[model samples]
Target: MDFSLTNEQELFQQMIRDFAENEVKPLAAEVDDLERFPIETVEKMAKIGIMGIPIPKQYGGAGGNNLMYAMAVEELSVVCATTGVIVSAHTSLCAAPILENGTEAQKQKYLPKLASGEWVGAFGLTEPNAGTDAAGQQTIAVEDGDNYIINGSKIFITNAEFAHVYVIFAMTDKSKGTRGISAFIIEKDTPGFSIGKKEKKMGIRGSATCELIFENVVIPKENLLGKLHKGFGIAMKTLDGGRIGIAAQALGIAQGAISETVKYVKERKQFGRPISGFQNTQFQLADMNTKTEASRMLVRKAANKKDKKLPYSVDAAMAKLYAAETAMEVTNKAVQLHGGYGYTREYPVERMMRDAKITEIYEGTSEVQRMVISANMLK
Candidate 1:
């Protein structure tokens, strides 16, 4: 099988890398310090077609492939994890389901706006009680003629405050358990739909995680995504793709840490010699870069499977598990190599360490990924 990127893909990567370095990188520290979303920088990303990297051109997007999208996320993540997630969530979670399952009219209505960056997108599957147990959806949707009245809350929702559109899930028939759940397309301005408490996160603070409260919110019946009572499948499938994005994000975070750590080691002296000259430091850098390379390959393998329309859930699980763990490991070492400076915000390593952590927790936890891989392997 071919493992090399096409020329077009390479160009896309280079262009995005340049943009991230020049634009998003400048704001990374400020965004984290202020805990504010960098709307201006995101607008710049959108204008450059980075926001819709994997979307087809017919839908107001750049008409890129998933692997290219992964590369783009990785490049942005190398500088700003928040920017990486913002693009990742928009493409993988929100736009993907609609593109894959929506009716022609639904696609015509939503995809262009999301792709054009006229509106950012969000997915709402997690609740206070439902995280890895996505089936335990307490949110209920009652049919009312041409409208569905939705009442539920989603916690830890990314892009909740700034998103104009959301893909949400709720129980239509509780007795049926997971099968009874259904997904919907809900607008932020819908009556009874409001933002709840904003979370102060430990990392990727600019990504905007918040509680999404829907109290008797009414939406058109036309907004029902996929088949009714079949949204549990949609939610699971959406995450299969989402995991690839998170893995790419993790891989990028690790790459960033190693690049910084290598520089620090060479310049940092111990025992009257450069730290890089020490065998111990050499081995540490070797391990960090080796793990990062492995993570990149896994992420790309998953992306390739996805792009080829092959079964990719298992590949995605493996990629996310390995890459996220690698991110945590590599970033931890980066801080250690930086010594006292790593412990303080004066260095990027400290911030990167914090950012590296969430990759393991969100999307699917490392434990959840193992379960997915094991289940698939057993099957």
Candidate 2:
């Protein structure tokens, strides 16, 4: 079993790393400090084709694969996790669903614009009462002549503020429970559809997260995505891919924290020598690196399975669970190694620690990932 990045993957990684260092790292602190979305950087990435790395060239994407997409997310996350999630939610959560499930007409109509970054996309599945219990969705859609009238709201929708397209879910038949759910492709400009106030989050603040309100919003029947009453399956499959993206993000966060700590320990003197001279610091760094490397292996394995079109639900679950836990643990240790300085905004590690937390919560919480893995094992 040879484990190596192909030459193309290596080149793509270098390109993204350089872009992150030159374009993203400079603004990361300010983006966090002011809770500002780096829209300009996003535009720059679109122009560079980072926006649609995995989509086919016919659809105006860069024609890369899932592995490349995961690598892009990892590299972006190393410098700025908010930016990482922007791409992840856009590509994995939104665009991927359409690519995988949409009809040819739907694909031709939407994928080109989405792939070109002419339109940013978002997914709306979670709601006030529906979170982990997705079957509890209260959003309703009633069929009308040539259209559907949707009424309800979704909370915690990433990319909600500026997304031009949304892949939304609602109940068409509440009696059917999860089977009642259906997905739709709704445009942002549809009448009575509006974005609510943005959430002030604990971390990844620069990522646009807000509520989606659909007050009798009307969309044509053509907007119905996939088979009716199969939205839950679509959502689950989409999240399988999304979990891989989050795993990569977690791995990158761990790597970034390690990089910062290593530089600090090598420079800071203690007891007449650099802290790097201390065995405790050495041991801690060793553990952090080991855990992070393990996370990388898991992330890559899941991504490879996806690229090969294999069943990867279990693979993604394990990757996300381990990587998210590793991120939190490593970032905490990174703070400790920085001493009092780590507690302050002067050091990026503090922000990194904050960013590491969301990886455990979204895409599927660590608890949820465990459930997925265990359920598969028991089955």
Candidate 3:
């Protein structure tokens, strides 16, 4: 099987990499330092069609595939993980699901705005009590005349205040457990729907993360995303794709850390010589590069499988698990290589290290990934 990227894919990768270095990198440090959302940078990404890489052109997207989307996320992440995740959550978690499951009318109404980046999108799944236990949903949506009254809240929502559209899940029939769940499309202006204060996070601080509060929020029955009681399956499927995006983010963080470390080692002098001249540094760099390369292959393999419309749940799980760990490990070594400087905000590696951590924790933890892999294997 050919592992080479097509010419178009290669060009897209280069284009995004250049954009990250020229535009996104300039504000990354400030964004992290001030915990500011880089709205301008996001606007730039949108202008370049980065917002909807995988959505169809007829729907106002670039008509790219999953591989291109993964590549775009990776390149952006190398400079700023916050930027990477914003696009990832928008594309993989929100737009893709609607494109796949929304009724024709829903698609016609939402996809154009989402694809054009006129409407930033977010997913609302994790709640105060329902994080990894997605089936343990407490949010309730009661069917009213021609509308559903939603009353519950979600915690740890990304793009909370910034998103224009949200894919929300709630319990339509508590008696059915996971089968009772359902999905809906809620606009930001919907009455009684509000965003909570932003959370002070350890990393990726530039991305807005907050809580979503719904109190007697009302929406038309037509807002139902898919068949009632099948939202669990839709969420699981969406997360399978989301894991691939996170795996790409992890791969980018690792690669970025390595890149920073390589430049520093060649210039940093110790004991009358450059650190790159030392056998220890050389070995460490070798190990870091090897592991990062492996992560890239795994991430791309998952993307390729998804592009082929093949079963990629296990592949995505493996990619996210290994790549997330590698990002953390490589960033740790990158800090050590930088010595005292790495510990401070003086270098981007420290922030990269901080950003790498969430990848392992979110979008299904490493433990969750193992469960997915093992369950499929044993079955």
Q: What is the lDDT of residue 79 in candidate 2?
A: 89
Q: Write the per-residue lDDT of candidate 3 for residues 22-141, one digit (tens) a residue.
A: 999999999999989888987888898999899999999999999999888898899899999999999998999999999999999999899888899999999888988999999999
Let me know the TM-score candidate 3 reaches against the reference structure: 0.99
Q: Count the backbone clashes (under 3 Å) in each candidate.
A: 0, 0, 0
What clash pairs does model 3 have? none
The TM-score obtained by model 1 is: 0.99
What TM-score does each of the candidates earn?
0.99, 0.99, 0.99
Residue range 6-97, candidate 1, lDDT tens digits: 88888888898889889988889989999998888778888878778778888888898889889989999999999899988988999999
User: Alpha carbon lDDT of residue 64, candidate 3?
Assistant: 95
User: Which digits, one per residue and each the tens of the lDDT, describe model 2 over residues 309-350?
Assistant: 999999999999999999999999999999999999999999
Q: Give per-model CA RMSD.
A: 0.8, 0.7, 0.7
**Candidate 1 lDDT score at position 199:** 98
In terms of lDDT, which candidate is stronger, 2 or 3?
3
Against the true structure, candidate 2 reaches a TM-score of 0.99
